[model samples]
Target: MPRPKSPRTRPTWRRRFALALKIFVGLGVLALIGLVIAVYVARAQLPSFDELKSSPNGQMIRVHAADGTVIVSLGPSYGEWLSFDQIPTVMRDAMVAVEDRRFRSHIGIDPIGLARSAKLAIERRGEGRRLQGASTITQQVARTIFLSNKYDVGRKAREAILALAMERKFSKDQILELYLNKVYFGGGAYGIDAASRRFFGHGAEALSLSEAAVVAGLVKAPSRYSPTADAEAAVGRAGVVIRLMQETGKITAAQAAAANPTGVALAPAPRQNSVRYFTDWALPQLETLIDETTRPLDVWTTLDLNMQRAADAAVRANAPKNAQGALVTIDRDGAIRAMVGGTDYVSSNYNRATQAVRQPGSAWKLFVYLAALEAGHKVEDKVVDAPITINGWSPRNASGANRGEMTLRTAFAYSVNTVAARLGQEVGFGTVADMARRFGITTPVDTRPAMVLGTSDVRLLDMTRAFASVANQGVAIIPYGITKVTAQGETIYAQAVDRSQVLVAPYVAQQMTDLLQTAVNTGTGRAAQIGRPVAGKTGTTSSNKDGWFVGFSSGLTTGVWMGRDDAKVVPGLQGGTAPARAFATFMKTAVANRPVEEFDTKVTLPEWALEPDEESYFGQPDNGVYVDADGNPIDQPAPPAEDSTDDGDRVAPPAPVPQSEQNPEQLDQDWIDRVLDRTPAPAPRPTPTPRPAAMSAPPRVPEQPSDRVLIRPQEARPTQ
Candidate 1:
């Protein structure tokens, strides 16, 4: 009877058990829902690897200029990726030997490597060596693409799981390909091909066995082994790789010993984030050429590799021994052809061409005078070079000496610092600033009297672009590197020349061009003379902090800048010296095979206005025929009243001065005295001056001849 009673069911206990079962079922359903949601989210977040791989878009690439002369690159590129099939067997074998000894046999998991790594770690732990890591190639690739480098037990567990999953989904070869393409091998490069190029200056296929071993070693610790990071250590470590390859039987001992004694030459140059002058000129134009939001883009730019090399060489070839330099070139269509950011792109990536915002010094006079021309002031206008202040800022000439009253043309030609200051003020600071910006000046401009004297800081690229606008006859086509973009062979973008507006009057451009021509012919820019009709302007920063030569031929425009990376000024270097000379040398060689073209017909001046007085402002002057704004001849009825005044009192006959000496106006007698100091004791030839006359004939407009405009110097005579 007692046993029967004990067998009675315990309803409370049964109720608790049933409730626990219900709770488990509900929790399982909730977990299933959460997992479905997570799967969807993860899928949505992941980009299609196939699409990314197949597309050759959303990338910047090198292209040719009109003359087929330069190489220009832009953006954090995923371009020109070399395929696995294209890679050399030697390189692949080296990678396998150095990174994964059993890459082909273990289906990417490499169990044998794992066992060996565990044993080593255990053995080290026994001896307190603290060694670690057993990652295979597949694990490394997964970590690179989908995980961070942060170390932790949980992270290691996850990496192993993902690697196993990846092995299940992809073949060993596919995993290797992904790994090869996704890894960063230092030098701002991501992928074996780019790494190959960055480290060896050639394609992966061209790498030697030693080079391959070096690259393989980098896979373990890229930054530590980067030649730029530490050249001596990197090269030294390469020897270890060669030895390891031999020990592993991947390479014979003889082969290892026979490898290049130099090891891998991964010393291309330190990649720099400093401004790139040429790229600065070229990028804005590319923005207009593609629609990046909708799809990937591949831009085929206009770049001439040879010209780029030449420009770089010219800048570096003649740079001050203690200074660095930059050079940029663009075609007539506003396409960037070639760009060298610095004298040594490898040693320094600081691209002065785009980013060096130093004072333009006297080189800024070009814009000051151009603005004057646009403001209805003739190049022959006259202004006082005395100690006058503009907005409380007094500017001095380059020579720190000023000349009295002189024609604007002469002031500009001489680069009279004081005269330029006055003209800049007269042109209206706001107007000049706007004009300069419109013409492509990128740095912040100081709207003070000193601006006329080039007190405004500007990058080499901006200086070059502004000059390009002037050379393009006032139609500013912002320099563009990329010409067109495509996606999966589908044309997506095509860049056409888009000149927003005329920066200045066409006549003003021609006049400015003519004025620059005179500089190349006889003034400071004399060293920049070319066989063809070329035009450009030169600049020297204060204390010679920066030197520049920006010029353009009919089909191309180029600029060169030289200076120190740390803003250390060079001694005694002027825009007209090495900078101009380099420009001239490059231009001469570049145009040797091309026909010489003249600037569009020169503007005929009405003979009423004085000869271009721009020179007086910059302490320089031009000697063109005197004319008026109306292009008419001067009708003044004044003959040289013979004996009216002796040569001594002959108004001191406005003397010649350097562009740097036209400021802080000095007594006409003092200026003449200085000129005399520079001149020979007794000159057989007398300088000619235009006399006041009432000529009835209309100003003679040189016919638009089809001959090359010669740049020879002879009393400022016209080649036409």
Candidate 2:
């Protein structure tokens, strides 16, 4: 009786057991409900990812020139348009078997597969192996379309959600197609097609079972397992995939054993810049082509890529090994179609055409001739080439002394340094600087006394632009690379262009162009002649530190520059020697297929248009604009007269038609009376004071040249 009262232990135990059973049943019921809800939600949301791109406008684009020349590139992912039928059947089967065996049975979420994976994962913490990818093709496709390459439980959950949504909306075949097209295969390839072509030089549909396994294996880590990019790693991965296939019964052991010797045969990717020169000319003008996003825009220039290659080959063929060089070609309308900044892009990105500021040498003389014509000088004007001094800066002739009193034609033909300097000094340096600036030479120029001898540093691009202005009859058009840009056929940006304007008098420009043509034909630029009406000028910097040839054809304008990177000089190679030779080489080959045409025939030649060989071509035909036939002057000069003349022969330009005596006709008779009286011409009345300001720094004196210079003649060996 006492024991019974102390404890009804057995009865109490039964009650506690009943309570535990009830709690367990309640928890099971709740868990089952939650799982059903999760399954339904996953099935609902999984297929939405396949409807549209999660990242719209995420396109990697390439920058092209006006001539359809590729320059730079943008974007990260590469995708191809394809269908499921295009994929290798083996790839789909293997991925389905290993990644999601129950893929066909599940709606979107595979809970049974997940449960088995969880159980095995827990059981084999020590069973180390290569890799384990339980993601189905749908899940992988969803992740590729919407998610970043981040590893986390959240990422996995999100992948599953998207996969479910994707599977609901897209057929399994569609998901597979999207997966193959979106997966990266490394080595700059973006999709299965790209990867297949890159790795095997064939289509993805043509892949063998072994090849399919190798590619499928790369889905986990493209860069790490790319057969073409990394051989040893890919072989090891392919072996793992083959083993998995055998273990999973996708392939037999005998079949895998027969599929031996895994290797990747690599092929080099072709360049998009087949017309590099055309792209180069278009780059500076492409600023307007870019959207705020810095995306690359396509530009179809006038370049023929194959012909461009021939042109570039011609330039590089002559370039000295490892030497620096630049080339540019454009249409007469200032549409640049081709360019080569250097011999090789992998070596340097310094765009010589638009970046290198070097002495234009005789090329600068073309501008000087223009100035002389505008200053009333005819082509027949004579100038004494005797040794002359500009404030102790003695300007000498390229040829020996005393090309004495030669016509402006011979002086320009010979590229006499002294004559050019004298004309520049007489016409006003400010005028020259202003003319150049108006013609699109944005680079700063110190219009000093030295500039008279063509001592300013000029880029090949600017030089060519200036020549183009002349070719267009003073219509100075800024060269533009990009013409228009679009995304999926939607225009985002456009290149705004202004037509050419009359810079110099049309006749003046034509005269100058004719001079340049003669330069290519018979002057220092003779090497630039390409069996066509190619107008060009040769330039050699002081001491040969730089060489240049800038010219234009009816269909194209081209410029070439040659020098050393270290600023070292090269011997026996002037602009006419190497730079012009390079230009001619490119031009001859570039225009071989096109008909030979003359300079712009529309450019009217002025009555005063004198040949470049005319003598006594200094200081205008009869005082230029200062004294027209009626002796009517225009565009008066600035005043504040001081010393009318400077030391040496630098006489100040006519004083702004003395504000009080603005009429040149009134002073005309007075000027004639003084000449007739011959009172020793009263030492010639001086005009305004001469400004004594130096332009840029002194001209560089070359010590020698570089050996590895580019565009070297086959026999032209550069001295060490």
Candidate 3:
């Protein structure tokens, strides 16, 4: 009986063992089936070899100046596609040692490395640490070419399957070529070829062992290990790669030791062109002309590199220590030839020339004078420059003093603030704003006493365009930089040559030009005189926060602004100092060898049009709309209603009609009577009562020539 019991225990043990074996076999079978299904699915998702080869890779976009010189290159570009033979043995070995130690031995996926990594990853998960990646070079290529960068296990499985499939589809050399080309190096380069040329200024095959090691190290972290960006970090990374090469038997110990050079010979950084601002300004235009996924286009711009350099030098030499400077030069045809957005773009790239909006100060007087001229005011018209107030807001001269009455031209040349305010009021703020818009100043203009003094914030580029209209003899110029765009050698876009409309009457513009010339000759902008005929104005804000000199030569119009970004006052900074000197320095070089040309001195208005009138230029309507400070409409008493007749005939009043309600015929008769002495013009009607009060604070005093303390002439001129 005892023997029978012992035999039954052995059978029980065998039965238990059999059950465990069956469970293990079933799980094994299921895992095999799952792996086969995953492989099949991944295989179907993989892109075809030909399709992968032909996919759009990053390409270069070249920007050229007007003279066909390459100013800069912009791109997400692959330098030059290279075959396996084109890659040097040293570079290939360095990349293999650093990126994938068992690249050649593994069939795309390294099972040993993956298992070890998984073991460590499992342990790290328990410790709550990040898992390390164990992807081979082939797996990286597969992930780059055919898979999205997903981090889940399912994606890893797919990546492994695709990598295995790639191994079967292409030779090791082919896979290596693709890997080299697909990896990203720094500075917008995408491949070894581009990276080599970008960092070393040479082709991949020309890379030395040390250079190759540095280039290979960049594959791990392009920006961190860029030879051009971080020389120390790049050399340190190269040392690691060199050590790995020695450990992998790719190079002898002596060779590895010899390769440890003190420094890497990175290419010298390209000189920053003066037209960098132009490219930056044109980039948005380029984006609009071509789609994001479209091939790179050649952007031909109207940049004159020589002039750009000159402008850049002038800005750097003239800008104050605490201030930044901007300069822009436009041709007579509205072509932007040169633009220096800041003294040093590398230090700050805010593009002050095109992007910053600051008070124009006295430079804005141009529009006020033009508006007055358009309203039948002659340059010689007398304007009282005594202290003036509107709605309890008094505007004073910069010195807090004023000249008695002065001619409009003389007042303008001296930058008389009270007279400009008076002129703005006589012509109407709306009329001044309209004149600004017509001259291509698109920024919002506040209709205030100070607006005539340029209290409104306006872009430097817009101001340059506005002055260009005066230089161009009233033709409206829309400033532009891009000239043409080509893709695949086909013209995709070209700046259409549109005829500019007449913004100001030629005669009015001529008169304004003459006044500006007077300003440069002996007034506030005398610092801007360049020997040749020139016209310009100087502007300095109340606190000396903004200084400007905007002017034009016969061949070019240029504007310069000097200011601190934070709007802090720069001591001794005035438009006549730094900005005017910059304009003179830049214009001297810009107009070299060109004959000095004079402005057309002819005034376009008729003799009668030169006489002042009571009504505003655009005519005050009967709807009671008047502009307040800030350009908002203010309700004013409408002109007294005239008696209406139903007989379709109008009667001329015998008594002298009131100025506000007089018809055109009555005004003409009154003017003719005054001119011919037939009847003495009725004593001028009293100025209408002030409009509704709107201003909350006093108007700031505007800069004036008399107020300016001419320090030393050397203070105005910057050292070269």
Best candidate (score: TM-score): 2
Error of 1 at 14 (Å): 33
TM-score, candidate 3, is: 0.70
List, residue by residue over 1-720, the lDDT tens digit for candidate 2: 455454555588788898999999999999778756665676665435344433432555666543454445445533345567767777777566545667777766677766767777877777853124566667776677678768778888777766766666677767666767766767666667666766776777777777777777777788888776677888887787778778878888898887653644555555644344445445455454564453323444555565567657756765544457778776666556677777776656667777777766667777778888888887667777766666546654422234467767667665766777788888988788877787777777667656755556677888888888888787776776556667645677665667746688888887777667655554556566676687777766544456777887756778888777776644434666567667777777777778877664322221222211122222111111221111123364333222111000112222344667443233343554465352332434444222223211122233334322121111111100
lDDT of each: 0.61, 0.61, 0.74
Per-prediction backbone clash count = 78, 53, 1
How does model 2 score by TM-score? 0.74
Number of the predicted model whose lDDT against the real structure is largest: 3
Write out the backbone clash pairs for model 3. Answer: 507-604
Q: Per-residue lDDT for 1-720 in model 3, tens only? A: 455456556677788899999999998999888866766666676666556655545556888899998778777764666778988999899989998989999988888888888899888797875546589999888887767877888778778888877777678888898888777787888778878878888888788999899889987888998877778889999999999999999999889888954566778888765567888897687667666455656789999888998999999988878689999999988899899999888778789999988888788888899999989998888778787776555655543445476788778766766788788988899899888888878788887555777767889999999999888888888888888888757888889756558887899889899888877764567678787888988887655567899999867999999988888656556676678888999999999967889787621212222112212111121112343321124465324222111100111212454788654433264565577454443546333333223212123323333222212211110100
Which parts of model 1 are misplaced by more than 4 Å?
Answer: 1-125, 128-303, 320-327, 338-349, 377-411, 415-430, 442-451, 484-494, 537-549, 560-572, 602-720
Task: Judge candidate 3 at residue 42 and give its lDDT.
Answer: 64
